[model samples]
Target: MKSLDRKFTLWALAWPIFMELFLQTLLGTVDTLSVSQISDGAVAVVGLSNHLFSAMMTLFMVVASGAGILIAQRIGSQREEDARSLAMLSLKVCGVIGLVLSVFLYTQPGLIAQWLNVPEALIPLAESYIAIAGAGMVFTALSAVLGTALRSTGNTKAPMVVGVVINIVHVALNYAFIFGAFGFPEWGLAGVAVSTLVSKLLGTAILYFIFIEAFHRRIGWKELARYWDRSLLKEVLHIGWPLGINMSAWVLTQLVIYVFLATLGVKELAAKTYMNTLESFCFTLGYAVALALQIQVAHLFGAGRTRDAYKATYKALWIGLAVVTVNALLLFSLGRQLLGIFTDDAQVIAIGISLLGLNLILQPGKMLNMALTNALNAVGDTRYTMVISFVCMWLVATGGSYVLGLHWGWGIVGVYICMIADEYIRGILCLYRWRGQKYLRQAEAEPALGVGLSAREQELVQA
Candidate 1:
């Protein structure tokens, strides 16, 4: 097998991740734009159901994240064969879970939609979208596993290239299907769902082939099934469960708070929807950096470079914070124009303007939290992150939204305030953990994931 051109620099890794995430954000923007053409009600419906579908994706993340972290460690330890086995297990597991979730979402979108307190008029549109887009979860599952595998090995570019293709196909398909151009039937929002399904399937297939070629590995379904290793599964789960639960809690909380905004009325919900789409533009940049930090820190930790790994987290955090601040400001300056691109409602646009200004503070705080959490996750310090996230997401973000936004009559701005507070509080605690060097202690104990170095030796290596 060929050696990977493993340049573990932050920028090298993060740029591709940023481009990939940016393309994904663009796809969401395009989807929202297409749906907006139908009606603001359609936009609200698509946003509501899609958030639910995206929430269910946490299941896929648990397996993929566990395997990806372990794979990075194994690669750092020069155990390629073990990493390959873990990759196969992740693929198999995520595929099975995705199919199960897909069926549930498709079969009972209406039930969940109602439970979410979706407006009665929008319930039918939400059901159609949830059923169609929900079915594509299988493709999304496989792609997550494949993408994580490549990234764990320092090959972020392959997935970014594939994203380019996927987004192009989705945009073209959206035009054809939504407008009945190119001799296709106009199925409105349902057509948008179909386009998403086709694009996801295409991207997943391409990524699978690329993973095989890049890693010089061959896979067969029957062979993978026949050689299922319970022990490997256990190892992955041990490392990943906390991280998964943390993520799941956060997303579910977002869903809950969205319901709070929904109760504020259609205009408030529409503003929230439009604000979310625009916010992703800034969020993706920060998130991409945090993700790259995890990958880099994982390899350093695995290779016994403890001091380097520790420093890498803070270094990436500073850079991420500075870059995201500028990005947030740029987006805020264009907030009204961007809001106008989605709708002509003066009320929704006015509400969105305030939200964008709030996001300037929100994005920086979010970047801080994500960078620290991913750094800890890379070094297997997930339990603390999981605990802090569970507590803060529910109490600070979700619970506070109801109390302040509802009880105190602060409205949507109050929800944003609660969210910002959550981000900063969680981030500060993570920073405190990093300073205490508990992650270092954990690393020294678990030599395989940690850089088997003593405090004294780490200082020398870092020097």
Candidate 2:
């Protein structure tokens, strides 16, 4: 591919993934906004459920990230058949994992809520929301894997279209069920959960039709049962497990931080929830660009163009920083208005607005960390990435938050300060890792010919 041509490829790959993240964030925003109409307790319940959900979703990311790397490499090497097989195997494995997770969470949601130290008044709402969402774990897994597969093949538009459609459906359903509008029941928080599950299941079905049947890339149940490729499965697990564990650990740290904050009381808990909602919108730009970089850099690395990979990484990093900076400014300018959208409570809005200004400090460090980590993982340097993540989240974010925020009685803002410090520390570390020569060495450790693509298939990757 020409140098200029690769730039187009980067945008083509990144934009749809970016839209997907944006839509997902929009869906969350809509969910929170709609639920806030019920009560602040309703918003808090959804917020707590989302924190738990993030940890649960990490399992799917484990598979999706691993499968994406393998698919990108196979496509790069011109191994179409192996790429297809890996995609099929990933669906089966993720399905089983999702089933296990759904069962576990559904059966013991109250127990899970208890562990989170969720407020007694909100525990029932939280448990109800989680149980319903957990039941749809299989659909969530399928949507994530199929979307990643499409992205791996340079077919970003299909996933973006599907995500937008599903998000629209999600928002409409949320409005109807939350308010009993349009002949729907006023199910409140339960309605939100039902809408989420239904939307995800529909998304999975749509993706299956588009990617599998329409594209003639479908891998059926028979294939999954009869053609279990042990070696391919091992390759995916080797690459995917660390990444999954890394994500799971990272989310668990956030949950622990939430738990620490719970010790401060409901007002503090409610403030944290509103701030996170606002932060989600602010961080969407970085998250979207980071995702795009992961796919773009994966293609470059798989094509054995290390120089091009580095260039793409730097370009993406700069772009992410610019995007995040703008978002921070927007938040600073409109912080109170955004907070008011979530709650009419004057005190919650006041605390949330104060927290929003501090987000300007937090967002840039997080943007850098997110972009570099995704870039590194795209090149298969996941083990080191995982180790670094484990250390920072455990030592600085979680441990330090406990000491400074809770132990010192700094309250919600104190916890936010600790979070900012953690992001900067990890951001600098990831930047240093990308700059060093060691990343290439880690990439070299993976097998070059494991997937066995053909020349034309490889050219498709470079193109």
Candidate 3:
């Protein structure tokens, strides 16, 4: 494809996902706002509960993204059967992982909440929310894996549509359940959790039907039982395990930050909660574009078009920077107005606004790190990315947040300053990794093949 054509293709791939993410963000904001009507404590409970959910979702992403890389490469190399088999294996692995996580998280939520130093008053609500949400892990895993499969095959629109519908359902249900509207029993925070679970379950069912009947990509129980390709499984684990660890570390760091914020007292925790919601809105564009580049770059690399992949990455980086810059500026300009939508408390709004100002500097660096890290993973460079992520988040973000924010009495703003420092550090490292062309070597060395393929074909396969 020509440069202009490639840019357009990337945008086409990104925009729908962008809208989907925007809707998802809106859904979150609605959920928070609806719960906020109950009390500030309710919002805090939701935020704390969501930290646990984020960790589980990250684990799911590790497997789904790893499978996506292989699927994209296989499709690029015209290896349809291999791609299908990989998809089946991905489903089975995710299902098993999801089940284990569900049981563990459901049973141990109070321990986890206490570990995070969640407020005593909010702990019960947080625990209840997490336990209910954890029950939907199977649906979450299936939806994520299948969505990634579709994106890998260059069918981004289907996933986007499904995501939109899912969020709509979530928002409607959240409204009904949170307020006892439409004859639904009021469950408050727990109601939000139930709504999310039901939505995900419905989404998984819808996607499964779409994948099997509409797209004709069926993976029966027999295929899942009989297709135990050890080598392929190894390839996925080699790439995915590090990614999982990296994500786990990342989530743990956030939980640690939550612990730190809880010590700062309830107002600070509430401010962080509102800021996180606003930041998600601003960052969605970068996230959407980065996801698009990840799939496109992986496909190009798998097709042996290295130069095209590099060009695509550069294009995506510039686009991500531009998108984030604009959003950051808008958030800064309208900071108070946005916060007002969620809470009437002037103190909370003021604190959230201050957090938004700091986010202006933080968001750009974060966008850089997010784009480069994801693109690198697409080319199977998870090890390096994971190492950098763990070190920066632990040493700079977690450690610095504690020292600057808590130790020195700087409060939540100081914690945010440390977060910005961490983002810049990792962002610079990711840029260097990409510029040094280390990922190119990694991609060339890791050859993917079905155990049944011939040695020569395996070696010569573009992926």
Cα deviation at 220, candidate 2, in Å, is: 4.2
Model 3 lDDT per residue over 1-463, tens place? 4443343268877987788788878888888888888889878877877786778787777778788887776766667777777787887788788888888877888887776677888888878887898788878888888888877777777777888888889988998988899999999888998998999898898877666532345667666677777777777777788888888998989988987888888877888988999999889999999988888877777666666777788889999999999999999999899899889898888888778778889989988998888878877788999999999999999999999998998989889999999989988998888888776765555545432232346666744
Whichever of 2 and 3 has more lDDT, that candidate is 3
Name the candidate that leads on lDDT.
Answer: 1
- Each model's C-alpha lDDT? 0.87, 0.80, 0.81
lDDT of 1 by residue, 1-463 (tens): 1232356678889999999999999999999999889899888888777778768899889999988988887777666777888888898999999999888888988898888898998888888888899999999999999999999988999999999999999999999999999999999999999999999999999998888765546766666777687878887898889979998998899899889989998889889989888888887878999999998888877776777888888889999899889989999888889899999989988999988879999999999999999998888889999999999999999999999999999999999999999999999999998888786777676664235222334456667
119-234 per-residue lDDT for model 2 (tens digits):
89888898898899878888888888888888887777888898899998999899898889999999998999999999999999899777665234566657656767777777
- Candidate 2 C-alpha error for residue 17, in Å: 1.4
| Displacement of the residue 428 alpha carbon in candidate 3, Å | 1.2
- How much lDDT does candidate 1 score? 0.87
Q: Candidate 2's error at 173, in angstroms?
A: 1.5
TM-score of each: 0.94, 0.92, 0.93
Ranked by lDDT from best down, the candidates are: 1, 3, 2
lDDT of 3 at 187: 92
Ranking by TM-score: 1, 3, 2
Residue 58 accuracy (lDDT) in model 2? 90
